[model samples]
Target: MRILLWHVHAAWTTAFLQGPHTYLVPVTAERGPYGRGRAQTYDWPASCVELTPAELAGADVDLVVLQRPEEWALAARWLRRIPGRDVPVVYVEHNTPRRDVPDSPHPMADRDDVTLVHVSHFNDLFWNAGGTRTVVIEHGICPPAAEYTGELDRVGVAINEPLRRWRVTGTDLLPRFCEVAGLDVFGIGAGRLRGLLPPGTGLYDDPPQHELHRQLARRRVYLHPMRWTSLGLSLLEAMMIGIPVVALATTEAVEAVPPQSGVLSTRVDTLVEAVRWLIKDPETATEVGSRGQAAVRARYGLDRFLAAWERLFKEVAPCMSTPSTAR
Candidate 1:
């Protein structure tokens, strides 16, 4: 089936491209200021089209998949202009708590044509979108089998930015936690948040995805101190590579990481203690990492995710007119 996916988020793009179908992507003229530049774009084996807004308006598109709520207006316009009013529009929610926008209560939330797809089950439960048709589609990972057996001394933390003061990502909590744990933390963000890094922790400017994965594999433990939001793709990727995660017991992390895999706590002292415990006991950490890797492969692999999407698309797509129905 022909699908038009307009997802600015690179990870979403990567996931959709893995499916077997025609895909259309909208390219932006501007580069992303935060994070590494967009993931390299390549023509997929399936019929693929890359278009600008003007080109998209004139093209014969089928389904339009939007990744952000802010893009609803543009998507709505496209839907209206499409030849048949039966075209389905899907919204992929990548964030949690849904507080990025003021709680204005969008009218589109009540529309049957618009379907909301959350990246995590936690997000689907927490977000306030007023009775919209919602589905949970967790992020998928393509993990390498070759494990990193090198010396693993460092602890890694990956984020697009050093947590902003007002944002709920728990940036301020990291420095204090690092002070007590003495774990080396590295992250990606604008240099503007320089002083935000804990005293002796190392910081690497945003690196490419493969490079970042390599760097993460070198670290013995991955620390996810996010106070709010759904489980991040990076956290899942680390687990896929057999790295135990020390994260807060919030959102999807509670569901993603089992008790044997890692420690989950809400208190700062508990978080610090978990990091130290993992650091002191390498064997235990390794075992937990192994369990995590197995779990990720069984549940969050690309094949399972693609299958789920296929079922979803088949169910959601409008019924084509058969010869009998047309008559």
Candidate 2:
């Protein structure tokens, strides 16, 4: 099947494109948000091809997977075709509610033209996607090489634009966790809080996915303190990398992380204690991390994710082949 989607979430897109389909991503002369083409920093498959707006105008796309609200207008202008009207479409909502809970109106609300896909069930329950058909396809990871060493005693956390999204990303709480052990933070704008962060904090800019996983695997424990947002991909990656996780039981996280995997609680103190314990007992950390590794692989395998997506695609776009996951 030929699928057209904007290059928005690179990590999500990278895993999505691994499916057995031709993925056409828009590319401009000067790559920006709308047209990042292919990931330069991360390795992606050749099947995920880059096509200009002009080329896409004549391209045969079975379905247009829309991520952003503006992409609907952009698709119509670029493809000279209306999304969901002239072409089948699936709008994927990656984040949680922006304004208020159960009251925040989705941008594509009250639409029957396209199927709204929520990455997590928690997001589907919260967002009011009126009139639009909604489905839950929990996140899945294309496993990176098993690299968890637990050799480093520092705590690892990944966040983007930490200062700007301080509260949402739980950036202000970094100091609290710093007292447990040294911290190695990775993501966009992570280095901005060098002065404000505690002495144990070490910041790194956005690194490639492989490197991110490799570095994160070295940490004794992975910290996920996001207070408001959808389930982060980093947490899942850390689990897949066999890193013992210590996350706040918020949003979809409550459902995602089981007790046996690591330690998840609403109390930050409990989380800090768990991390300190993991640091002290590397063997116990590895045992707990192994449970998370097994659980994540069983639940969020690439094949399962792609199969679920294929089932959804078959529903909206009749031209697609039978989905093995579909009943």
Candidate 3:
């Protein structure tokens, strides 16, 4: 099947493109937000092809997977096909509600023409679907090959635009964590935190996914400080890399991190203490990390993620089928 999707979330898209299907990604000469084309830092299969707006005008795509709200209009303009009407469409809700807590109505609410897919149960419950068809497809990823060494006594965190999304991404909480252990931050706008962060904390600005995993595994424990998000792929990647996790017990972090696997709490002091203990006792950290790794593999494996997507695609376009694995 030919799938039309934008390169919105890199880690998620990377895993999504691994299946046996041709992925048509929109590309603009500017390579801006809408048309970033394929990922340059991370590796992707040849099956993921890039098409300019002019090229997409003539392409016959089997399904349209919408990420952002604006993509609905872009698809109609570029492909000359109205989503949900001209082509089967599935809108992926990748974020937690930013407006009202539990009262926030989803943008696609009450829409029978499109199906809304949530990445976490927390989002599914919080976002009032209001009669909109919805399903939760929780996050999954292809685990990196790196193993946790925990040689460094520092904490590792991965979040994009931490400066802009300060409180939301828990950038305000970083200083408190830094009081316990130095933090090595990785993501876009991470470098902006330099000089602003406490001394000894390191900043890496959007490194490649493989490099990020490799760096994260070296830290004694992975810190997920995000106050609200669907489920950070980086947190899952850290667990998959066998790193002990210390996360705030908010959003999906509670479900993602089992008690034996890591420490989760709403109190910052409790999380700080947990990180301090994990850094001091390397043996305990290793054991906890191993448990988290096993749990993540069982629940969020790449094969499971892709298979669920395949099922959804089949349901959306029954006539379409996975092509040969030639790519």
Clashes of each: 0, 0, 0
Order of the predicted models by TM-score, top scorer first: 3, 2, 1
Measured with C-alpha atoms, the lDDT of residue 120 in candidate 3 is 92
What would the TM-score be for candidate 1 when compared with the true structure? 0.84
lDDT of 3 by residue, 1-327 (tens): 889999999999988888888899999999999999999989989989999999999998999999988999999999998889889999999999999888999989999889999999999999998998898887778879789999999999999999999999999999998887888999999999988898888999999988998899899999999998889999899999999999989999889888799999999999999999999999999999999999999999887888788889888888896555422
Candidate 2 residues lying further than 4 Å off, grouped into runs, are 321-327
TM-score of each: 0.84, 0.96, 0.98
| Per-residue lDDT over 18-133 for candidate 2, one digit per residue giving the tens place of the 0 to 100 score | 88788999999999899889988677888889999999989988899999999999999989998888899999999998788779999989998989999999889999988889
Supply the TM-score for candidate 2: 0.96
lDDT (0-100) at residue 268 of candidate 1? 73
Compared with the true structure, what per-residue lDDT tens digits does model 1 show for residues 1-327? 667766466655666677766677665577332112235532234455666666667766656676655555665564346322457677777776544444534334665667788888877666666877888888776665436441466677776666553246676776756654444444456354567565666677676666667777877788887877677777788888888888888888888887687778888788777777777778888888889888888878887787777767766774522122100
Best by the TM-score measure: 3
lDDT of 1: 0.67
Residue-level lDDT for 142 in candidate 2: 77
